[model samples]
Target: MANVLVCIKRVPDLGGEIRLTADAMGVDDSSLGHTVSPHEEAAVELAIQTAKDTGGEATVLTLGSEDAVEQLRNALALGCTGAVLVEADAAAYGPADVAAAVADVVRDHEAAGTSYDLVLVGNDASDTGDFQVGVRLSYLLDRPVVAGVSTLSVDGGEVTARGGSPDGGTEVYQVALPAVLTVMEGGVEPRYPSIPGRMKAKKIAIDRVTPTGEPQGSGRRRLTLPPAQPSQVTVLGEGPEAAGAVVDLLESLGVTR
Candidate 1:
């Protein structure tokens, strides 16, 4: 049976307008809501389904504040068997630091007789947009790695991954077991937790660990939000006289020969 690990992040919900901090170093989440990143949600779903198919267990892990337990529990509600929380201020750590802490957890788990057959992570975190954690973790763990995977399946100790190519085609990769995969959104449809699932998740205790190590410097000075795009509308005449204007518009748009 395959043992799977899915890593997730708690990010500000982007359903509303995003506001930045005064120094532009981070998002102003005081007025915003929080949820798991979209890609990570799909990763969690994929892990749970894989475990169910392979007759194994799915475990969710995250590196963030104690409040991140909410997200871990959410994963459990979606059918994860258990969860682990590496408690720390997520904002204080860079991609390398996060990767190191996750790697440490994986090693510890493996030493304790629970070697993971697959480790899943989002292609990038929604808030930080950092894409290094999965690759860094693979390097640290000496495992094969694949990124931007939109579909995944395992059979006979091999994993088949499929991703979209820029050329409007598909790119496929077949990697051995015990690999790391960075999942993108649209990989799988995430399930909503039912009332019974929520109750079960609330009763499950999360395994908490305090990450011990110095964080690596990211060398990032600050963050900057992009300016909003401006839109414009053109008005034509309002009558039969507008016929000529319509023709001109169609010509300009190359819709008319």
Candidate 2:
């Protein structure tokens, strides 16, 4: 059975209005809820299924503030067997810093005699749109890596991954074990947490580790949100009195005589 590790990130929920921090260095999510980054959610699902099908186990890991445990627990609720929290103030982390943290965790885990045969990651961070973590981690680990993979299947020590190509056709690769893969969202649908699953997840002890690697410099000076488009609406009468206005509106659109 192969052991798999999936790296995930916690990002603010984008369901509501998106605003930047007062300093313009980050998202103004103080008033919004947080969720697992979309593609990473799919990576979590893929890791679970990979472990199950191969008689292995899926471990989820994240690097961020203590609050990131919420996202970790959510992944656990979705069926990950273990969770690791590399607690740090990630407000200033760039893609390189995040990658260094992850690489350190992989090496530490391997040194502890827990070898992960497969490493899964999201194609990019939804909030910052940073896409280099997976590639950088692979370089650190000196392992082959693939990004934007939609689906994959493991057989023995080899994995067959499939995704879109630059030519707009499908691309497939047979990568050996001990490789890293960055997953995209279109391949797998993440499952919701069941009541029992949530209960179990609450009781599971999370492994916390301090980062041994120093963070790379902050990658951004500030953020700027796009200008909101002005919305215009005409009042059509509120009741029977508005019927005439509706007719006039339809007539203006050439839909009525």
Query: In candidate 2, which residue ranges exceed 4 Å CA deviation?
Result: 232-257
Q: Work out the TM-score per prediction.
A: 0.89, 0.89
Please, what are the lDDT tens digits per residue for candidate 1 over residues 1-257?
Answer: 77899999999887647788898778888877789889998899899988998998999999999878889999999999889999998888999999999999999999998989999999999878889899999999999999998888889799999988999888999999999999998867889998899999999889999988878756678877678766576778888989999999899999986
lDDT of 2 at 108: 91
- The models' CA-based lDDT, in order, is 0.90, 0.89
- For residues 24-122, write the lDDT of model 2, one tens digit per residue: 888888888898788898899999999999999899999889999999999989899899999998876788888888888889989999999889999
How high is the lDDT of residue 216 in model 1? 70
